[model samples]
Target: MGKVTLITGASRGIGYALALEMHMRGHHVIALARSEDKLQALKAECNDNRMECAVVDLGQPAQVDQFISALVDRGYTISHMINNAGALVNKPFGEISASELRHVYEVNVFSVFELIQKAMSVFADDIHVVNISSMGGFQGAQKFPGLSAYSSSKAAVASLTECLQEEFGEKGWSFNVLCLGAVQTEMLAEAFPGFKAPVNPSEMSTFIADFTEGAQKFIRGKVLPISSTTP
Candidate 1:
C-alpha cells in the first residue's frame, strides 16, 4: 500500500477531484463524505481498490465517533489529511441565527479538530495537514455583504492551522491552510449564483494535490490565497 491520505468532503467538487488525483498518483485515499451513493460513484469511477470511503456527516459528533471507530478497527495509517469539508451560511451578521453560526463552526472548525484528535492514532511520522479556508475570511480583505458566519468560520480554520503548526512542528508534523479564492463548483454556484469563477475544481485540485503530496516542508504554517481572474 502507498502512503494513505485522508480527505474529507470527498463526494464532489474539489474534494472529489482531489481524491481522484491522489489515487491516480498512487496514494491510498480514504474518502469521507455524507453521500454514500456519490462516494460509491467516485470509487467506481476511479476503478481502483485503493480508494476507501466512509459516509458520515462531519458536523455530528456521533457520526464522527462512528467513523473514527471504523477507521481504528481497520487499522488505517495516514500520512496526510485534507480537511476539505465545510459549511457555509450566507447571512448578514444580524440576520444569521445562533444555530446557523454554531452549525457553520461545527462543520468548518470543530469537526476538523475532532478528526485530527482521532486520527492521531494512525498518523504517520512527518504527517502533513491541510486545512481548507476561504479568501473571504482573509484578515482585512474586502468584506462581502452576507458572509459573516461563513467568513468567521474559515478564519477560525486559518487560526487553527497556524496554532497547530507551532504546537506540532517540532514533532515532525506540519499544518497549513489554503485560503482559496473563488473556484467553480457546485458549492460556489450555490453560494454565488451566476458568478463565474476563474478557477475550476479540477484545476484547483491539482494544485492542492501537490501540496498534500508533500509540499509542506517549504510552506508549513502558511495561509496561501489562490485565484485566477480569468473568466
Candidate 2:
C-alpha cells in the first residue's frame, strides 16, 4: 500500500495548508474537518485523486470512531497522523461554563486520545503522530488571560503525547508535540482580534510538513516549542 497521511481540521488555517502540502508531496492525503463546504473547497483546489476529504466533527467521539473504522474497512494504513484540530474559548476562568470546558477538552484532548487509540489498527509500522499544541501549553511559556479552558486542554494534549511516546517508542512508532506560538490563522484572530501574527498559516504549515516527514527519525516523545514571539 502507498503512504497515507491523515490531517484533522483540514478545512482551514494551518490544517488546510498542511493538507495541500502533503498532497503535493504525493502522499494519499485524508483531509478531515466538520465543514463539508470547506472540505469541498479544499477538494476542488486539490483536484487530485490522491486527496480524500472527510467531514468529521472531532468533538464527536462516535464520529471519530466511524472515521477510523471506515479507513480500516478500506484497507488504508496511515503513515502520518496530524492532530491539528483545536477548540478555543476566550472566556475568563470563572465565567467559563462546564459545557464550554467539555467542548474544549473534547476537541483538543479527548478526541485526540480516541482517534489515536482507534487509528492504531490501521497505522503503518513507521507511523509518525504529530500533535499540534500551543505555546501556552509549553512549560515556562507566557500565558494569556481568557484562555483557561483552551490552554489547559492543550497542556493535557502535550502531556499525552509524551506518555504515548514512552509507551510506544519501543515499537518504533514516533510521537511528538509541536507547541506553536501565534500564527495568522482564524483561531488566532478569534482569540486575539486585530493582532497580526508574525507567521502565516502557509509558512507554519510548510514547517510542520517538513518536521512531520523528517523530524521523526531524530526526535520522539519530544515537545518542541515552535515560536518566535510571545502570544
Candidate 3:
C-alpha cells in the first residue's frame, strides 16, 4: 500500500488545487468534501487511479469518525493529513447567533479534533498534520469586523495544532499551523465581497502543498504566517 495523503474540503478552492498538486507530485490522495458532485468532478479531472474522492461534511462529528474508521479498516496509513476544511460566518459579533457560532467551531475546530483523534490508528510513522488557519486568527494580525465566530474558531484550531505537537512531537509525528492571508477563494469572495486577494487558489495551494510535504524537515510544532497581504 502506498502512502496516502488525506485532504479535507477537496471539492473546490485551495483543497481542490492541492489535491491536483499532490497527484502531480506522485501522491495517492484521498479527497474529502461535502459536495459529492464536485468531488466527482475533481476525480474526473485528475483522471488518475491515485485520486480517490469521498463526500464528507466536516461539521458532523459522527461522519468524521465513520470516515476515519473506514480508513482504519481498509489498512490505510496516512502519511500526510491536511485539515483544510473551514467554516465561516460573516456576521457582526453582536448579531451572530448561538447556532451559527457553534456551527463555525464545529467545522473549523471540533471536526479537526475528532478527525485527528480517530485517525491516530491509521497514521504512518512519519505522519505530518497541517492545520489550515486564517490570518485573522494569527496573533497580532490585522483584525477585521464581521468575522468574530470564524476568526475565533480558527484561533482554536491553531492552538490545537500546537497542543497536538507538544503531545506527539516525541513520537516523531509532525504538526504545524499555517495562518493564511487573503487568497482568491470562493469562500473569501463570500466573506468579503469586492475584495481581490493577492493570490489565487491555485497559486496558494502550490505553496501549501510544497510546504505540507517538506515543512516537517525543518519545523514542527510551530505556527507560520503565510501571507503577502493582510485582508
Best by lDDT: 2
Q: TM-score of model 3 relative to the true fold? A: 0.97
lDDT per model vs. reference: 0.86, 0.93, 0.91
Ranking by lDDT: 2, 3, 1
Runs of candidate 2 exceeding 4 Å displacement: none
> TM-score of each candidate?
0.95, 0.98, 0.97
Candidate 1 regions exceeding 4 Å error are: none
Local lDDT at 189 for model 3: 90
User: Which of 1 and 3 is ahead in lDDT?
Assistant: 3
Per-residue accuracy of model 3 over 110-133 as CA lDDT, tens digit each:
889988998898999999999999
How many residue pairs clash per model? 0, 0, 0
Question: lDDT of candidate 2?
Answer: 0.93
Candidate 2 clashing pairs, residues 3+ apart or interchain: none
lDDT (Cα, tens digit) per residue for candidate 1, span 24-60: 8989999999999999999998787799888988877
lDDT score, candidate 3, position 200: 92
